[model samples]
Target: MTPVLYLDFDGVLHPADVRVTASEPKRPRVYNGGSTNHPLLEHAPLLERILAPFADVKIVLSTSWVRVLGYEYTMQQLPAALRERVVGTIWQGELLQHPPRTRYDAIQSDANNRGVTRWLALDDDTEGWPDEQRYALIAPNNFWYGLAQPGVADELSQALALLCAGKPLESRLPQETHVPSTVERIFGLG
Candidate 1:
């Protein structure tokens, strides 16, 4: 099976706190249908750099952008090269009143339905993920910069390398350790 990279956009591609007003008095911006006009869109290349080497890696959108912008437009927002790597999306237009308790549950539901065993989720929210799957997630401690933070992309790449090498989900790499501090573990900064 091809390894899937479950990707989120708001916090993963750019700053989650970036505010957008309906009226922009400052500058004339190229507006897509949705809020893909992030200043950090320039960081697309950084994501590409890490993902490029893993030819077997396929992308699966776990971002809400897919629902708002439409699948085709959301795919266009990504770099042209990465567009082809996109195989599918996690959300399928379901309007659940009470959505899955956490992002991990939603991703796992999709993964389970798709029969995807080899996969890693890159998201900012790390709530409710069990330790087994937590190792597979390369969550950003810094929401503003996401993977652009120093060493984050490298760590993500390394994790992908291990996954692509056929390592089981339960296997822990040398760099990975159980966080002793309660705060770090709770926030998934471990």
Candidate 2:
């Protein structure tokens, strides 16, 4: 089975908090209170580099951007290399149901429907995820750095390597504990 990667755009591809003005909807601005000087999709090349050797891996969109920006427009934002790997999305165009499902639930349902046993989710919303399945989640610090967070790229590469090898994901790498600096605390990036 080809390894599947559920990709979240806001946090995983770029900074989490992106704002767009009606005058310039095409160009979104990221404000982290000057904590980091990274551009939109600044970490995309890193992701592209990591996935370069794993040619069989497929990507599934799991970001809310699809709902807000539309699927085609959202896909267009990705670099050509990453965009080509996109196979589908988690949003099935269903009407909003009462008591919205969490990211884990959506990913689980999508995986099950597709019979995908080898899959991982790179997301920031660390809510409603069961303890046992935590290994499948690569959550970046969305409030601040997102994928640009130190050690995140390495962890992602390691996880992808393990996944492509058909190894059990339970042996996931340990996450480095991050203590926010004074500036980060002031900006609420911690």
Candidate 3:
């Protein structure tokens, strides 16, 4: 089965925001949806419930959540089992230094790592991408420009349905995809 490349957390797994308080300097902040009333965390028991149908599928957490919230902090919030299913993650930290090019590069890298020829990305940002090709431009319920989340959402069934039928981008743009042979280095595939 092909992997489902999930990117948006608010639409695919959680409510988009949760309050988290920390001491020291005394700060109250919001998390990237996963617990309490948040979509994915609220329905933690439903991860398998939702994924059992796609047992052959694999998941790639291509979110900036790891960078913002930190890897350990996010994984600890998972409901044990789902935490194990994740093959890996791609944090768009430095990518943020760039713009649309960064987003495009990260997606391509994630796809390559998973050996994904076909996948879908549930993101609110479709800045430089085309709608006719790969990845879904699914907008989340309450998506923030720079925040990140780590699961599927409750209200994105239609988008997910489209993702189920999604295809990969075949863009000829130099910035959209990077085939190894096209790289300047010659150590291996490049």
The number of the candidate with the highest TM-score is 2
lDDT digits (tens) for residues 112-178 of candidate 2: 8889999999999889999889999999974567787888888888999999999989888466799
Once superposed on the true structure, which residue ranges of model 2 sit more than 4 Å away at CA? 22-27, 33-38, 95-99, 173-190
Q: Which candidate is the best by lDDT?
A: 2
How much lDDT does each candidate structure score? 0.76, 0.84, 0.51
RMSD of each: 7.7, 9.8, 12.8
Instruction: List, in order, the clash count of every candidate structure.
Output: 0, 0, 13
Candidate 1 clash total?
0
Compared with the true structure, what per-residue lDDT tens digits does model 1 show for residues 82-148?
8889998886745233457787888888888889999998888888989756887888878667878
Q: Considering TM-score, where higher is better, how would the candidates rank from best to worst?
A: 2, 1, 3
What's the residue-level lDDT of 157 in candidate 3? 40
Write out the backbone clash pairs for model 1: none
lDDT-better candidate, 1 vs 2: 2
Write the number of the candidate with greater TM-score, choosing between 2 and 3.
2
